[model samples]
Target: MSSPTRVYVSRLAGLPVYAPNGDQVGKVRDVVAMLRQGTQPPRVLGLVVEAFARRRIFVPMTRVTSVDIGHVITTGLVNVRRFEQRTTEVLVLAEMLDRTVTVVDSETTAVVFDMAMEQWRTRDWVLSKVAVREGAKRFRRRGQSHVLDWAEVSGFAQVEEGQGATHILAAFESMRPADLAAVLHDLSSKRRNEIAAALNDERLADVLEELPEDDQVEILAGLDTERAADVLEEMSPDDAADLIAELPTDTAERLLTLMEPDEAEDVRRLLTYEERTAGGLMTSEPVILPADATVADALANVRNAELSPALAAMIYVVRPPLETPTGRFIGAGHIQRLLREPPSELVSAVLDTDLDGLRPDDSLQAVAKYLATYNLVSAPVLDDEGRLIGAVTVDDVLDHLLPEDWREPDKPEEDHHAS
Candidate 1:
C-alpha cells in the first residue's frame, strides 16, 4: 500500500516566543488567524508572543517555534492590554464565521493549520489553550476552482514550472483556475484544451487563438459548432477566415452555418479565394465615402470611425447611392495630401482618377508587388463588382510574410537545403 501522507507545520502548538529565536522568549499567547492577500479561506498559523515584549510571529517551515527568518509583526501598542480588541491587532481577516481546521490526524502535538506569525513575529509569543480549532470543518481546499485539479498557483493562477511548480503545489493548493491560467503559457495540446474548456467563453477565445495551429484545431474540434462560431466571430475576420479555411470542407461549412449572417457571409467571401491571394489575406472591413463629400467631411468620418492610419491611403470616392454594396466607387486619393487642400474641395476633385486598381481576386504576391511598385503606403482593396472591402497596408503585408524568428538562425540543415 502507498505510504500515508505527511504534513508539516513551522509553528509549535504550545511554544510561543516574543522575539526571533526566542531572544525575548515569552509564553504562547492567543493565536491570530488572518486572510492575507492572495490567500483563500484565510489562514491561522502566526502567533502572538508575550516574552520581554509582545509581538506577532509568522510560522515559516523548518523553524517551528524558532526565530528562523529574522522578522517580527506587531501592532502599535506600548504595553499589552487585558483582552485588547483582536480587531486592533495586525490582522487581515481574523474572526470568521466559517473556517477550516487541520489537526495532526496522527500526533496530537502537530497543529496542521493554525494562526501564528512567522517565527520572528511570534518570538516570545504567549502560548495557551495550547490547541483549539474554532470549527471542526477541515479537509483541504486544494486545486484551481476554475481550471484543473492539482493546479499550481504562482504570479497568477496557472501551471507552475521549474522550482516554482513544487512550491505552489506545496503552498497555495487552494487557488482559482483563473489565477492559475494567467500564469501558464506553454501547455501541451491536451492540457491546453483542458484549461481552455474550463475557462469562460471570452477567456477561452483569447487563449485558444494564441495556441499552436495543431492545438487550435484540436481544441476547436472539441467545442460544438455554435461555441466555435462565437469564438471565431470575436477574432479578426482575417485570422478567423484563415483558421476556418484550413478545416475540412464539411467542418468549415458546419461552423460557418452557425456564425452570424453578416460575419458568416464575410468569411464565406474570404474563403472563396486561395489562402495566398490578396482576397484571402485582406480584411473585409472597408472605408467608403460618397463622391460628393468634401475633404473635411471625409477626414471627420475617418477620425470618428477610428479607421487605422494604414487606411489613410486609397480613400475611395464612390458615386452617389453609397448604401448599395454594388455602388460604383469613382477613384482613390491620398487623404494625407488632401488634408493640406482647402476643406471645401470636393473629395472627387482630389481623388486620383488614374490610381491603379486591386481586385480581391489578385494573388498576395501581386498585392505585395503593387505596394512595392507604386511605393504606395497603403492601397484600397475591392471585390469583383468594385465594392470596397479593405485597405492592405505595407505593415500587414509584411506581417503576412515575415516570421518572428527572422533574426534567429536557420533550422536543421535538412530543412534548409530543401529550400
Candidate 2:
C-alpha cells in the first residue's frame, strides 16, 4: 500500500478541501506557513484555505488533510472561527501598536521601508554572506522558513546592525500580510495615518498636504461632504486656507459651515490675507501673558500650556504705560534669555524695549527678512489696534514659502494591506 503522503507549504496550491460530511468543500488557496520554535517543520502551522461558499480562510494545519501545491486539501470548517474573526474585521497596519516585528538590511535595523523609521530607529543595517551548507539548509528550509535571504537578494544591506536584530529584521520584512500588520505600528500620526488610509482605515484617513493644492482641493471635492469636511477640519490652518481658497466659493462656504466655530473662524481669518503674508500663514494660538505677571507665573503658564519657547516667541508685557499712551502693551526679548533666572523675577525687568513689529498686511518677503535679520524663530503679529492676533514661527514661515509641504521624508509609506 502507498505510504501516507507528506505535505509542504511550498508545494501546496490547488488542493481540494472537504466538509466534515465528506462533501467536496473548495479549492486550496495556498499552504499557510507559520513561524515555528526551534526544530520542527514549523509545526505544519496552517494552510492557505479556501471555500466553495465563503471567502478564503486560513484553516489551521491541524485540520489539514493534505498540503500539496495547487492542492491544500483540508477537513473541518467548524474550528476555524478564532482566526477567521480577524479576517472579517478591517486590519490596519497602523493599529499594530505593540506587536514586535523584525525588519532587515537598512540604515536602521528595522528595514528601510519608510524613511522616517530609518531616521527614528537610527540603527545600522547589517548583512553577511550566507553559507548554506547541506545540514544548515535543512533547518532553514524544514522547520523555519526564510522570507528573503540576503543570499537571494541582488542588493546590499545599506546599514549594519547586531546579529540578533539583523535576523529579526529579515523575518519581519518577509512576514505575511495578516502577520505583518499584526505588528508594524509605533510610527508617528502622519505615518500611521498614511498607513491606515492605505491599509484598512482599520477606519480611514490620509494626508492631502503632500499633493499639490489643486490636487488636495480636487480630491476633497470628490469625497462626501461630511468626509471632506473632516479632512479640511483636520488640516493645519495654513494648509486649510491654501486648500479652501482654491475651491469654488460655494464649496468653501459649505465646508466652513460644517467646521467648529473657532477653527472655522481661524481659517476664515487666515484666508482673508494673500497667501504670501504674515497674516495669511501665522497660527493664532500664541501664548500671551498679561504684563503684570511675574516671571515665575509666566514660566508656570508656559509649562502648563506646553508652549514651546521657540513657537510662542517673546512674551509681551501688556501692563499700563510702558510705551503706549493708552497704557496698552509692549513686547520683550525671547524667553530663552530670561528662563535661566528664577520665575519670581518681575516681568518689567525682562521686557525688551527694542522689539520689532509686523502689520497684518506685511508681505512674506518683508517678514522673512525681518526674522532672518533678528535670527528669530518666531515673531508676534499685531493687529492695527496693537493686539497680538497671532504669532509666526520659522517652521510656519518656511512651510508656507517653501514649494513643497515639509514633513519627515524618512517616514514610512502608507500601508496598503489592512483590508
Candidate 3:
C-alpha cells in the first residue's frame, strides 16, 4: 500500500472513500482498532464506511491502497455486511476521543482529543500517537496541548466510566440527526447514555426519534424522569407517542405526567389509536391557519425550518380553536396554489375541498392510497366531529409500509462485490 506514514484518525472522519477506478463508494465514519496487551499500541482493524442508504460497512485496512486528507482509495472490494463491533474491537472515534488519560512523565491527567495511526510493516497499521490537552493553569483561559507516543498515555486499556463526550460531539457537530443516530447505535451502551445525557433536550429529542425503538427507550430510561419528559416534549408528538408506547405502561404514564399538559395531551390523543392507523402516524402539529389568514401568513408558516418538506407542502385551513382537534375543518390549501395567489388573499380562497379528509381510524393502506391517488405529500386526519386533528405525511406512510425491522441492520450479503 502507498499512503502517508501517519494520519490522525479524527481527520479521516467524513473523508470520502473511493474505488481504484475513481468511483466514490462511501465516506469514512470511524476507524476500528484491536487493543493489545501491555504497552503495545492497538492494531488498526478497518474503516467504518457509511455507504448508500446509510448502511455502515467495514473496509479492511488491507483493502485501502492510499490514505490522505482529501480521500481514501480502496482496492474496490469491501464487505457489505453491517459492521458489528466484536467483544475485542473498539471504535476509535466513538470510544477513544475525550478519554481522560495520564501523561507518564508529568503524571498529569489530560483528555484525548485525537490519535494518529501509522502503517507498521507491509500491510498492518497501528495506533502510534495521541494528542491530549492538560487542565488550564491558574488565570489561563486555555489548557496546554501535547502530542505523545501511545505508550506515554496510561488509560486506554481500561474501560472508561463517566467518560466525557465533548470532543466526540464537537468533531461531528455538523452531522445530521439520522447520521448521529447511526453513530450512537454503534457505541457501547454506557458510552451511548453518556453522550445522550450531554446533549440538549431538543438535539437529543431529534436524535432519539431517528434511533431504533429499543435504543430510544434505553436512552430515555437512562435519563432522570424530569429530563426524560422534557426530551419527550421536544420530540414530535407521533414519534414521542411511539417511543412512549414501547416503555412500560407505568413508566410511560409517569413521564407523560411530567410533560407539559398541552404536549402530553397531543401524545395522549395519538396513543388512543392503533399504531398503524392514520391517527398514530400523524403529527398533531402542522401548518394550520384560520380561513382569514392570508397567503403571506400561510407561506411563513410552511417556511418554518422545523417543518418537514412533506408537512410543509400543504396548509390546513380550519375554524377557530387553531390547535389539534381544532374546530370544523374547512379545507386544505396546497402550497403550490398558495404561491400563485395574491399574498393578501385569504387561504380559504384556494382550498382543495374535493377530497374529504382522512379519519383517525383509517388503515395505513387507506392512508397510503389516499396520498398516492391525489399525488399529495400530506393529508389531514379529521375526527368524528369533522375537526382537524393531525396531518400524516407520505414519509410517515412509507415508514409503516416498510418492514418492521427496516431500520435494523441487514444480514450480510451473499456475495461481496467490488465497485
Whose TM-score is greatest here? 3
lDDT leader: 3
219-291, model 2: which lDDT tens digit per residue? 5654678767776666666667788888899989999999888778888988888767888877666556666
Of 1 and 2, the candidate ranking higher by TM-score: 1
Model 3, span 1-419: residue lDDT tens: 66788999888888999998999888889998999988899999888899999988889888899998789999887777777677888899999999999989878889999999999766689999999998765674567898999889898878779999988887788788999998898787999999999899999999998888889999999999999999999999999999999999999999999999999999998999999999989999988999899999999999898888999999999999999889999999999998999999988889998769899989999999999999999999999899999999998898899987787777665422222
Which residue runs does candidate 2 get wrong by more than 4 Å? 1-224, 227-236, 304-309, 319-328, 404-419
- Looking at model 3, the pairs that clash are none
lDDT of 1 by residue, 72-109 (tens): 32322213321222332332112210122223342211
Off by over 4 Å in 3: 1-3, 120-123, 136-142, 413-419
TM-score of 1: 0.49
Model 1 whole-model lDDT (C-alpha atoms): 0.50
Local distance difference test, per candidate? 0.50, 0.49, 0.90
